[model samples]
Target: MRLTVNGSILLTELPLLERPAAVRAAGFDAIELWWPFASSTPDQADVDALVQALADAGVQLTGLNFNAGDMPGGDRGLVSWPERESDFLANLDVVTQIGERTGCRAFNALYGNRQPDADPVAQDSLGARNLAAAAAAVARIDGIVLVEPVSGMDAYPLKTAADTVAVIDRVASEHGATNLGLLLDVYHLAVNGDDVDAAIAAYRYRVAHVQIADAPGRDQPGTGDLPIERWLGDLASGGYAGWVGLEYKPAMPASQTDPFAWVPRERRTAH
Candidate 1:
């Protein structure tokens, strides 16, 4: 399959060592990783070992996820914290360098929005400014910047696809930038009350990458509410030639984690 599955095993109770075997055992061409560089500096050998893991496991590093600033002593989001905005900028530089080293082409900088107590307009201005800075920084690298949409009903506050699009546009317009883009998360968009086809149709040319988690439970392909194959066909048809990222958590053991087990053989293309 041309799709990429992330070792989001970090978020789960799974041991990090097992993530690679799980990804390989499931037959994915690439694996996604959260931004190890941005979270903190790591030893070069440790970073090298990760690169080697991808090689030994035979999976490419497809994307790195990097979230922006959140407030200390509070739930303040990207738009609120001006104090540690340095961390956000520093993270971008780190991600760009990592992309150069590891061949990851895109990174997700999707930060949350606003403290419940903050004023809305002020938050927008803060987010837009930070995004503008982020756009300028990422444009210096070969890799692209990806912002995700979150759903308010879900748990995180900034879940709307429309909100993310607006933020990217505002940043790009403000900075006269070209590299800012979107990580279209199909499952989250659905959860936030968006139609996949409509969002895909609107943002086809603007998409830097796409990640797919089946809806309802965010599990393997056959168990969700999404019309997985047909929409994937539509994505390929719409000129989104990038890999379809499998970002779901498997409900079963890694042995049972063939994500495409439900995919009909005829529909799955040989990579």
Candidate 2:
């Protein structure tokens, strides 16, 4: 079980270009990132600079997200949003190109919040179509498309591991592409009252990526009541040998104290 820091979470206070080095300085060689630029389709210079940052820092980008609109402003994702479907499609090439450059094989695609005025059937159909398209696009690079069940957002349909897997299955079946997988986030599962053990037992084979954050306050591992180690151990025991992303909110600034106290320094590296 290798560990990878989620740059979006760990380096939230720094500029996008500065995050790769910060992650490396924190003793992690592999990191995951959300779409770093505000625009899904950013200029080539911005892309080159981000690639260069990771190269200069000696950190590998293990995973990346397709642009989920305004992460801090509560926009869950654009792929499934009817109004933003085109934007999501347009971003496929951009994200895939970045993935190719960064050696990121896993790409998370969030299901958008349900629209109140739109017909539910239409929304579901559109989401399926877009997800199928996404699956095909990333398959060109032998990348896996991840579908995650997010918690705390009432409007989002996927709130359980089962829900996420169902979508993964749908995309795989619809597109005949086996590159679709589930991104099991322990925080979201625990927060939504789902049985983490049962989820791993049922879906471990389909999991391509795993994210961790303690439940309740969504804080670092030891800061909350969840059995973070046991869960991680369970994931390993269940045959998940992939990178586990640290997607938690650090309790304090990194300069004051190490945010990864729960994980020993030596265990943090992918090597």
Specify the highest-TM-score model's number: 2
lDDT of each: 0.66, 0.87
What residue runs in model 1 are displaced by over 4 Å at the alpha carbon?
9-14, 36-38, 43-45, 67-80, 152-157, 255-260, 263-270
**1-271, model 2: which lDDT tens digit per residue?**
9999998888778888888898888788998988888887999999999999999999999999999999788899987789998899999999999988888888999989888888777877788888888888888889988899999889989989998888777766776767888899999999988888899889988889999999778888878898989988888888889999999987677778777777888998988
**Candidate number with greatest lDDT:** 2
61 Cα displacement, candidate 1 (Å): 0.8
In model 1, where is the ten-residue run with the lowest total lDDT? 70-79
Clashes of 1: 2
Model 2 scores worst on lDDT over the 10 consecutive residues at 168-177
Which lDDT tens digits does candidate 1 get at residues 20-61?
655666555567876543244556676677777777776677
Segments of candidate 2 deviating more than 4 angstroms? none
